[model samples]
Target: MHRLLLPIDALVTLFVLTAVWLGVSSSYDPALSYPVQLGVIVSGGVYLAVAHGLVTWRIAYVFGRLLLLASTAAAAVFILQFAYQDYVEVPAIIERIGSLTTLLPNLNLAWQHPNAEAAFMIGTIPLGVVLIVTSRRWLWRSLWIVCTLVCLYALLLTFSRGAMVGLGATLCIAGLVLSKKLIVRVGAVALLIGGIAAVALTSAGSAWVLSRWDLYRNSLYVAGDYVLTGIGLGDTFPLVYSRYGLLIQVPQLTYPHNLLLSVWMGQGLPGLVIFLLLIITFYLFVRRVLRSQPRRLFHAGWLGVTAILIHGLFDSRQYIEVLWLMGHLFALIGLTAACGRLALWQPEEDVPKVFRRYFPNRLVAATAIAAVIAVILFNQELLAAWHTNQGALAETHAELNPTLRAADREAGFRQAQSLYQQALAINPVWPNANRRMGNLYVKAEDFAQAVPLLEQAYRAEPANIATIKGLALAYMWNGQLEGAAEGFNLLPDPARMAEELLTWGYWRTNEQDQPLLGAYAYETSQLMLPGNVSIPVWQAAADAYRAAGELERARQWYERILAEAPDNTAARQALAELDDA
Candidate 1:
């Protein structure tokens, strides 16, 4: 039993960590994605209990045990692939099993670096394995502590807000219950560290972690639009895309920053209830273990759990690898307490009445152990169920997309407009959903509908570079020159000024302001893609110059445009018109 448990715990921990990396790395694909998540959750706790048993019995099974468990997991994945033919992701499966690869940037994932999963797994699991193997060695006794600090530092570098919050919460819990002397020392250290971290965070760290907070907030608002009663499970991606649009084209609903909220949105009240119950159960179990056991190890577990739970508040990996490991830790404590109680010296009179009456005559410990093992063994089914739930959601969106496309085909403008509205019904951040919706209205020469939607999207995502550009276009479509200029100011990068100026000039058609447009255009063209695009700005300036009867300036501007874009139809025509005039 001890041998069985140790490896299970290690694998569970690894699985939990790996799942988070996977989710952050990929899109929200129910057919293939969420099982890896569910596996971590279901197995993390059970295997953790087993690891605790190994630690208690001083077993030596970390390597072979972990290998066996990994094999089991790989086999399960293979079986799942065979079972759900449609959902099987061959490349993903190969990659997942292949371990860490190189760092690669994925716009969909919050962490910009590639092979983040490999880094986290390599950094974290060996600590557990080492702790388990060297349990009896005095030198290795402090291994867990050392590994934890290392993991914490590594986690910090990941700049994952969820991880940071979770780790912080865990430390706070440890500090709260620490013995008086230790508490004082820890408190002082904490204060100093906190002060420094705060200054750094305010200055630099915030850039590392919350670079995407605004995007997260947008997902929340968008989720409410489509998920009236929840969009059903696995519906986040399709719902987000069909409802919101390309601006938010990345699959988000599956792994929102707030993991619990994503579950609530996907699975509704039942999912939320299940999720809450799981947390409460783990908390109760861990609290019981801490109060009853009173060991320094238990205290360490408390800190780890606290960090995870607290961090969970800000960044959710509820169904991911982290939570799974947390579950294992909770189970290990519970198992340790149970095993310790089995050897308790019970006085005849002091024997708890409850134990005599309700506790079993036989070793209930074995039964409990078996139950935990069964949970680990049967975890595959739970993963399969989670995948099914995800699929239902994808189908819901698949069903909606065709209808949206059909509506679009009849009239591009009307389709874009209506699709935007329907998308907002599911995801408020359907990217330029509202922008296109408004633009469609503009194209149809219906400024009224276009204005409000564009305004709403702009306000919801004020920092989004694209949304501001879209709003400016909406204003241009409505011939609102002043409004376009105001919208343009919202952009963070002045480099976008060329596009903004073009929209602005189109709106006002005022030759005098062409210099304003020309200046911005020249600045943008000098720095950006296809540098020749700036030549048009000169041509527009020439048109304006001609209108103002500044013949020499107009000629110069026209000559510049012709020099860059020799086939410049507009510039050539303008020059001819100028010569004729």
Candidate 2:
């Protein structure tokens, strides 16, 4: 590894850890993403460590080069499959494999989108194409030409309007840099003109232009909201985008379709700053090293980095909160640095060794060891959360069991009990741990055992919506309405508690042929429904008030319903019955 590696790795690792910490510390009271994020970050950190340990730059370079080459092969296969699907018979093997792919134009998959895929290819394809010119050996040069030609054939099919425009821009720049020849330059200019005119008049072009505008606008909104601290990692951006990004209405969106904006929204300003710093470091390191490295792989590594940067403008996959997906980019950086070291050191004569002299760097060594220790020792919240999740999953399985098999259900319950115990052991007073265990006890109809756990949960997180609602409901079901009252008193907005109680009430009234809890929820909601609420909701709310013997309250609700919905015969009949009373 290069001497500069420590800082590069440090920044990237810090950014990653920061992202995990954000998830751990997110407002998710149960810290829903905490355990998963911790696992991802730790595992990703391990991969990066191991990936960098491909200490022989030559070895790492070969590994990365093969993967990049494989992408070309993948594209070619996909293009062939597309052609076959269009016309006649495809080989069963190819036909079956093609079924997994979703993007239809035959492309590299950036979120299974051809435009995005084309953008990424536009970035990396240059590196692959450059190999033909740089390779001294005819055998290697021949391979490069074949791959590049296949890649271009696929790229042409894969591209949409915006990608077409981007490709034209890239060709123009490449032509200027690669040759001073007038013919090539003029051709590049002509291609740019044709490329721009080729797609702009089409409906697809106009649609994308509008879609991208809205996406960009919404993305900017998300970025602006969390400008300083960022949106905080995990499945955060999607939610933040939905709420803050009011500009576009989307079914589901992972990113803003722009890379720099993605970093800003996910990590906030500090993350973006650190990311930029890492890029700057890569640029400076490459500048110093590129002149000395005549090796094809070394240059390819630079081009690979270039591919991501340029493609990133249109769409991003590697910068997502999912660490494994994001970590590959960092691995590439390490490989690039390693390639530089190998090139400058006369690597042909040097004996290749994995992690050669690695442990000598105490910082890296300690980081590796300390990471493990810290996760186990310090992250009590994550540890507890993992156990709690296992318990929840077990409970879900028990509930989902269709056979009503006692042994299976009992076994699942026992498994959940043990997992919850482990979670409580990890953190004695962790609110979610206590609360979930209490919920399990409630499920078993052991309110006596549930009370303390629910109390502990309420005490630990006085304002947690889930904890409050869960605890209050447990109290109501346990026939200790005072306990419910106490928990509910803490929350200024008791609507969730009321809502949960009503949900339970529905099950009791309709399913269990019991009305007590249902009546309680209805009274708690004060027979209140917005005027615009559906008739079904009003009927449910009315049922509870009637069950509670609040006939006048029920009558008032019926009158309110009949006022707006005069044609509702059910409301009129109910009102007539109430008038007789």
Candidate 3:
């Protein structure tokens, strides 16, 4: 049989596949090679519709409106989630909406991060703006206006400096290209310059700008080292950045902010080229079509796409933190690629005869098969993440999240345990899953199960405080005094765990009065506390050593404490007792 797609489609498909191949090969965790996969699925489906002339204007219109409505709802949710504030200076209305927003679960409905949400708002708000201008019904127009206003407010509230640049670009492009007046065109240029200046001069702007510079510099450095094959995707970039580059302390500053650089980081240079070629080919195709067959849909796409492009220059994290935003961006790309058909023909334009005969059926079958293969390949990691997330949500209400699951607490706990077991079975070395599952067993006082998982996590991230603390606690409870001592020694600071460690130390001390493990905990606490030896930790250390028959070590500590505090009765008494011994 003849091939299904046209030459253009075949070329685009080839580029996409090539990019995917490069992305997967170079990535540390290819399962999160998000850009290529999402693009293929979304763009391919939209292309099939367009190439077959299956997309009706009415269908396109409905989809656009639904997208606008969803953006409005999501914006509303983001606005109402005031408590988190992401440590940003939010509007005063945030305080008032706390009770209202608390009604919803924190189940990924805007965890209050603005990086992806800001870009999404930039992309989706244009649809509402278009509908507001085009809708004939007053009711529909009014609703669209409300949606646009809400999205605009939410966009500003995100305080994403990149988003502001994108908005400025959107407005300037619309004024210059869409308007007839020369005055408007000139004003657009002036407005853009002013917006840039404002963003650059905004309070705290200089700090972030400098931070971006650091990121860019380090990204370039890293890119040079792994020029042919990148460090990889997912947590790989962060890991590399921390180890080899100028790593900043900001959370989820995972990907390089620029889209091209991010692709290069994950997929190397070849993948970046392919990705650009694929996008350039399609968008240019849309541009050429619109010159002959102009329509509202194309204009709407231009406004949204312009925002993505301009914002992407300054900030592009299209993966990991927000999968839904990846879909949203790809959908826009697909829609832009396909919109010309709706304008050109009456029901829908007739596609080339070759594709018309076997277009969707053959394509869908091929895609399904590929997807099945991919699922099988990625199932272990994918399924493990899914189960681990559910297990975490069930075991404890998420950190900084007030909402808890509505199920019975005991049931939730048991379910968490079961889910974690399944996840670890599938991905035995997944650090987070192992840590959480180990914690669940620890909570049940099952020390045997907890030790190995904690040990695995410790091996993966030795510097991680939570992992070390968990491991230390498990060792202490399990009566592995040496293991417990090592963990406590490794802990940078045990100020928070001081009381608990002190109690454990005293309880486990031998008849000779020396703690089998508490000495290290006490010494570490003494080092970390503000007044290094101001607390009673020194006294406790001395007593534990004296009780352990370490007379010389106990005598030294007692003398040091007396050096700091001559009036310290306890140290004086201990020194007297040691001397008597």
lDDT of 3 at 30: 53
Candidate 3 contains a number of clashing pairs equal to 4
Q: Rank the candidates by lDDT, best first.
A: 3, 2, 1
Ten contiguous residues minimizing lDDT sum, candidate 1: 114-123
The local lDDT score (0 to 100) that residue 568 gets in candidate 2 is 85
Q: What is the TM-score of candidate 1? A: 0.51
What local lDDT does model 1 show for residue 178?
A: 56
TM-score of candidate 2 on Cα atoms, chains taken together: 0.48
lDDT of 1: 0.46
Which wins on lDDT, candidate 1 or candidate 3?
3
Per-residue error at 443 for model 1, in Å?
9.2
User: Each prediction's Cα lDDT score?
Assistant: 0.46, 0.60, 0.65
- The candidate maximizing lDDT is 3
Error of 1 at 425 (Å): 13
Candidate 2 — which pairs collide? 123-307, 230-268
- In candidate 1, what are the lDDT values of residues 1-581, reduced to their tens digit? 33222222333444345444433222334444465455545655554544444443223234223432442343233322322222232245444432332233222323222112222322233334335444677665464445444344334334444554444444454455554677666785686478448735684557644644655655554444333234433334444543343232245344454555655555453445444544543444354445454434433333444444444455554344433443443444334333333223234435444234323324345656886897698554333333323332333333343444644444444433444555565555444456545645554557666788878867766765546656665664454645665665555544556454555454444544544443333323333333455665666657655665667777887887788779988888888987897
Which segments of model 3 are wrong by more than 4 Å? 1-12, 29-54, 84-110, 201-203, 247-252, 344-581
- Provide the lDDT at 73 for model 2: 64
